[model samples]
Target: MLQIEDVLRDRGSRYAVSGGAVQGRAGADAFVAELKRVKKFAKATHNTWACVFSDLGPVKADDGEAGAGAVILKMLEREGLYDHIVVVTRWYGGVHLGGDRFAHVVTAVRAYFAALHSAQSR
Candidate 1:
């Protein structure tokens, strides 16, 4: 059986939008666009994103990222690991992430996600 929590766990995978002084709308748009681009370039069949804002709905998800993508981002937010962050999950068709590769992918996106979040926060 697959626990929802297990599926949601960040596992250190993240992508963020940060820096510069941009309004909520612009910031959100930028992050969303970037996520879409990444997904397209990765040739991923699925791409999902979630954004949390104090004054807004707090949580929003894009079905494109698939259920797992949305769930994983939510899990990370719940853990208080990030704010104003967006994460994208790519399911490689042939290649597989057994060890370091998996970690690398997650870390790379996490860093970018953090950066995006940081940028908007400013």
Candidate 2:
């Protein structure tokens, strides 16, 4: 299992990104299980996540972050990533970022992929 953590701060809000590998086609239930394994993000304002399980297909959840989940899902689809799950936990700073929030989510996913590549190369 691979994992990386990153925090993206913008508009007074902080987005904590958790990128990890999903063993086989773990399904949505396994996605939730992986999330429970991490205690830090449990209390986040929004824990939007997306996963690509090639065997079972792709699944995503908004967790109250609106279209943020879709943003991550699109990235996963573009990369053609398989057996991977990326969770972005946003701690709302009481400020609305509007469309800009989508950009931040993209950044988080990109960072995760980069990290995943670097890890594999090593």
Candidate 3:
């Protein structure tokens, strides 16, 4: 099965940016900027990204790393942060973090959004 280790290798962070339309050319630009910022912060060499932007809603995922990117994107969607954005960045650590460990990292990043959602809901 596909795993995180196959995608991410080390330190990473996920951030969401809201307050703007997440579709069309403008949305794509914003999303790219967010992706760059997150990648810069993580000092990641590679980045996979995906987005769903439309009148229907905003959704996206990176297909570069296949399953790994898809999984991360799904987690972001579950956070329910609409009219917003999410980017997952990773910095290679040289040592393999394994599939389980990698998934944990993705989960941890998603948890940040969960916390944000919880705080906003209150």
Best lDDT among the predictions, by candidate number: 2
* RMSD, every candidate, angstroms: 9.6, 2.1, 7.3
Instruction: Report the number of clashing residue pairs per model.
Output: 19, 0, 10
Model 1 C-alpha RMSD to native: 9.6
Task: Write model 3 residue lDDT over 10-58, tens digit each, in one string.
Answer: 3443332222235554675566566556435435543544444445454
Task: Please rank every candidate by lDDT, starting with the best.
Answer: 2, 3, 1
By TM-score, the better pick of 1 and 3 is 3
The worst-scoring run of ten residues by lDDT in candidate 1 lies at 1-10
TM-score for every candidate vs. truth?
A: 0.43, 0.85, 0.54
Q: Which ten residues in a row have the lowest lDDT in candidate 3?
A: 1-10
Top TM-score: which candidate number? 2
Decide which is better by lDDT, 1 or 2: 2
